[model samples]
Target: MPGGRLTHGDRRRIAAWLAEGLGYAEIGRRLGRPTSTISREVARNGTTGDYAADHAQRVSGDRARRRRPARPAEPPTAEQPTEVVRGFVDRFATLLAATGLPRMTSRVFVCLLTADAGGLTAADLVRRLRVSPASVSKSIGYLEAMEVVVRRPDPGGRRERYVVDDAAWLRAWQADTGAHARIAAAARRGVEIFGAGTTAGTRLGAMGEFFTWLSEQMSGSSLTASAVYDALTVLAALVHAGRPLTLGALAGALDWPEDRVTAALDAIRRQPAIADPLALRTVGPRTYTLTTRSDRLSQAQREALHR
Candidate 1:
C-alpha cells in the first residue's frame, strides 16, 4: 500500500466502469488517480484483453504481494505516536526507491526531506549517513544542480545545512521532467540503430511518448504532480553519474541490499544506447560523477531517440 495499489473493490469498480465503456481518463478521475495509474492497473491485470472484476483483483493483489513493506503499520488512532518526521522519511525513501534513484542521491534527499530541526549541517549528514564529507559535498552539489534542495547558511552554526523548501522540490521535479524527456528522446534514437518495428526500437519509441506524456501531465501543482515525479526521481538517479556503477557499491551506498541493486543495474544496462553497457560501473566502486559530457550525451541520445 506504500504506492497505493488498487483495492479489490476498486478493481471491481474498474471492470464495471470499463464494461460501461467509460474512458481511462474518466475512470481515473472517478478513482482520484492518474490516467497512467488507471491504464497500468487495468493493463497489468485485465486478462486476455478482457476486463474481469475478480481476476483483476487477484492480479493487483499479486502485484502488491512483494511490494508491501514487512513492518506492520502503527494504528492511526489518537493515542498513536505517528510522527510527521518519520512519515516524511519513510515516504521520501519509498518515493526515491520507486524512481530508481542513485544511492548517494537518494540518501541525501532522505536527509534533506526528513531532517528534524537543524536541516542537517554537512557535519550532521556526514555523521548520519556515515559517509565521507566529500561524498556529502558531491551529492549536495548534484542536488543543488537539480534544484531539488537548496543550501543555506545556518544562523546559529558555522556550517551550512542543505534544506528543501516547500517549493524547491517542485522546482527539482520540473527540472527532472525535462531531463526524462531528454533521455527518452535518446532512447527513441535507438530505433534507428535497431530499426523501427524491431522489438528494441519499438520499446524505445514508446519510451519517447511515455516521457513526453509524463512531463506534460506534471506541468502544474497538485498532490498527483508531487506523487507522479517519484517515478522520474528514480530514473534521474541513473543519469546522475557520467559513467557506470557496481551493483554492490550502489546497493551499499543507497542502503539497499546487494541483490536489488544488481537486479536494477542489469535491467537498466539492457536498455539501448545506454552509452555505458556495464552495470558494475553504473553502480560504482568510486563516487558517482555527472560531467558536462554526460549531460550532452544524454541530450544527444534523447534527440536521436525522439527522431
Candidate 2:
C-alpha cells in the first residue's frame, strides 16, 4: 500500500474509478488504500459526484505547502485599514462557519463576499486570507461545488477570478432543497425494500414525507420575477376591492390576461410567506379575498414578505 500522500496520478485514478460508479470500498481496493482514506480524500476535495482530479492535486499541494515553515514577516503597513478589514473578515467568517460551512471555506466566502469588485483571483485570496495558495484553491473548489462562487477568465488572460453572484443566495437555497429531495428519494427506496407495514418501513416513509414536504415548501416559496409581480398585482386589486370576489370577477377587475391572473393567484396561494402577509383567503368556490384584519399576520410573516 502506497503511503505518505496521494500522488497526482493516484487522484487521476481515483477520479476515473469514481466515474465508473465504483463505491469507496472497491476504489480503495484498487488503490491499495483504506476505504476511509478514499472517502475522506474525496469528501475534502469534492464529493464523488463533482470531484476533479486536477483540482484535487492542486488542493493537496496547497495543504502540504501550508504545513511548512513561513518566511520572516515583512513590515506591516496601513495598520488601521488592515485591522478594520481583519475584524470584519473574522466576524463574518465566524458567523458563516457557525452555519455549517467549513472554517477555511467560510473565510474564503466571506473574503469574496466583502470584496468591492465582487470577485477575487487566487493570488488575491491568498493575500487577503494570509494563507497558502493551496488553501485558497481547496476552499475555492468547495465553494464552486456548492455554487457559492463562480470562476471567470481573467481579462488579462492570467489567472481566473472567483466571483460571488447576486443570485448566490438563491442558488444556495435551491441546492439545499435539492439535497432534501435526494433524501426523500433515498427514504422512499427504504420503504420499498422494507415493506410499508414494517417498523423500519414506517419510519422511512415518514422521513421521506417530511423531506418531500420540506422540498416543496422551499420550491413553492421561490416564485419567478414575473410571478412575484403578477401576484402583487392581483393582491393589490383584491385590496382595492375590499371584498371577496369570485375568480371571474377578480379576472375582470385586473383586466389582465385570464391565464396570467390565474397563474398569479396559484403562486400566491402556494407561497405562505406572501399569502400570510397579504391576508389572502379563499372564501367560496373559486373566490378570493384579502383581509383587513391587521392582526391576521404575525410580525415574522410580515418581515418575510418584504424580504
TM-score for each model: 0.38, 0.50
> Candidate 1 overall Cα lDDT vs. reference?
0.64
- Give one digit per residue, the lDDT tens place, for model 1 in 1-307: 2247677788888888888889999988898888888888777765425988788777656766778757877664322324664466556767886787766777778877766545767877776666798998988887778787777888986778778878886787778767876877788788789987688987787787567556544543333433334323324464664455454555655676766554444433333122222222332453332223232234457689779
Candidate 2 has its poorest 10 consecutive residues by lDDT at 74-83
Residue-level lDDT tens digits of model 2 in 1-307: 3576798999999999999999999998988899998999999999879999999999888887899857887654322127678888889889989999999999888888877563788988887788999999999999999998998888886889888998898999999998998999999999999988789997898798678667767887568888888888888888888888888887787787778888989887676445543467888988888864343444567789889
Off by over 4 Å in 2: 1-81, 224-307
The true-versus-predicted C-alpha distance at residue 111 of model 1, in Å, is 2.6
